[model samples]
Target: MVHRMRLMMRIGRSFVSILFTAMLASPAIAQTYTVQAGDSLWKIAEKTKAHDVTVHQMIAAIHENNSALLGADIGNIKPGMELAIPSQTAASNASSKHATQLLSGTGSPFSTPTRNTRIDSIQKKISHIENEIEDTIEALTTSQDSFDAMVTP
Candidate 1:
């Protein structure tokens, strides 16, 4: 009887250890946030800082997790959209990608890569791009005018 009791105690300890290990190994379940009126992805991300993610990261994570619901443009998000709040690591990665975009001047509406950029540099870049676009449009309009003039009676 003593030997049997010892064996049962050992088995119980093993079972408890297995249970504890499994609980620790399980991944954390992500939380969800529903979009509200006048809410932007930036704002939602700001609120989700409680989850320990930066606003930029939160925006990126929300965009990635809800691409189907949000469609292509992050700026196109609407009221009542349900977004998944990603884990901290995932949010960090997303924010990194967004930061890259910002640095490359491909910023989304919710975020500008200019967070670290000098204000004067941003203005100059914007001015340069605007000038290039205007030149292209003017050239195109001139070519069209020439074609019209030649084709007319």
Candidate 2:
């Protein structure tokens, strides 16, 4: 029963993979965005129709060009303001990826790759130390038993 279930899943996955690959590889679909008045950063992001969250980066870029817009007042967005929507290309994807990576407590986003490497290294060291400790305690117990036996005799 489980074997059949696994087989079905594999077939379904391959079918979907081929379908989507053919879809994306074909002509690119053009997306359109209309600017409306009084739209806030959060509002624009919510409307972008992108699968991934891109509102924060869009808001960041908007503010970069116009620093005066960064005030705490969220009620002041003018109507019909033109804001450029960012593409989810490799450049923008990095920011989103980094943002997500941060939420899981792996490490700093911009840290040297060495930091990530060291985390794995530390984990390996901890596992090795635990194994060594277990072995040492077993050895100590055997030696203690032998000493007790000798003393008793």
Candidate 3:
């Protein structure tokens, strides 16, 4: 009886160890998200809370996982469309791989302008508009002068 008990204990320990290992080895199951009105990929990614990945990475993972449903246009998601939210580990892996590509100067799916860049862009546009206004005033003055000369004669 003593020998049998020890053997059974050993078997139980082995079984527990195997179960734990299998659980860790398996990938996390993905959850499904239903698209809502006014929901964009960016908004969905932001609200999903996938840890260890940026919103861009989450967006890319979502697009990759749901390519069949999303098709070529990521922006065309409509209300009631279901999306598989990638597992946290999957998103982390995808984002890490994508981050390397992005850091190496590869293109990103989205671009966010820095404050300075936006300010400079606005300044340039303002300068161009001012130049256009000045040219218009000069043209109008020239026309008026021509009219005055003709009327005086």
Index of the highest-lDDT prediction: 3
lDDT of 2 by residue, 1-153 (tens): 999999999999999999999998998554434456445444555576256536545444333333354333323345665444555552244354443332232454322323433354476689999999999999999999999999995
Model 2 / residue 122 / CA error / Å: 44
User: What does candidate 3's lDDT look like per residue over 1-153, in tens digits?
Assistant: 999999999999999999999999997776999999767666687788466678768866887788799765566578999999988767765664553332232465434433433454477689999999999999999999999999995
Tell me each candidate's TM-score.
Answer: 0.49, 0.30, 0.49
Cα lDDT tens digits for candidate 1, 1-153 = 999999999999999999999999997887888888766666677788545666667766777888787665565656787788877788877765763453344655434432323443466589999999999999999999999999999
Task: List residue ranges in candidate 1 displaced over 4 A.
Answer: 1-22, 25-27, 50-52, 97-153
Q: How far out, in Å, is residue 39 in model 3? A: 0.9
The clash tally of candidate 3 reads 0
lDDT-superior candidate, 2 or 3: 3
Clashing residue pair totals per candidate (backbone < 3 A): 1, 4, 0
Q: At residue 134, give the lDDT of candidate 3.
A: 100
Query: Which ten residues in a row are the worst by lDDT in model 1?
Result: 111-120
Evaluate all candidate structures by whole-model CA lDDT and list the values in order: 0.71, 0.53, 0.72
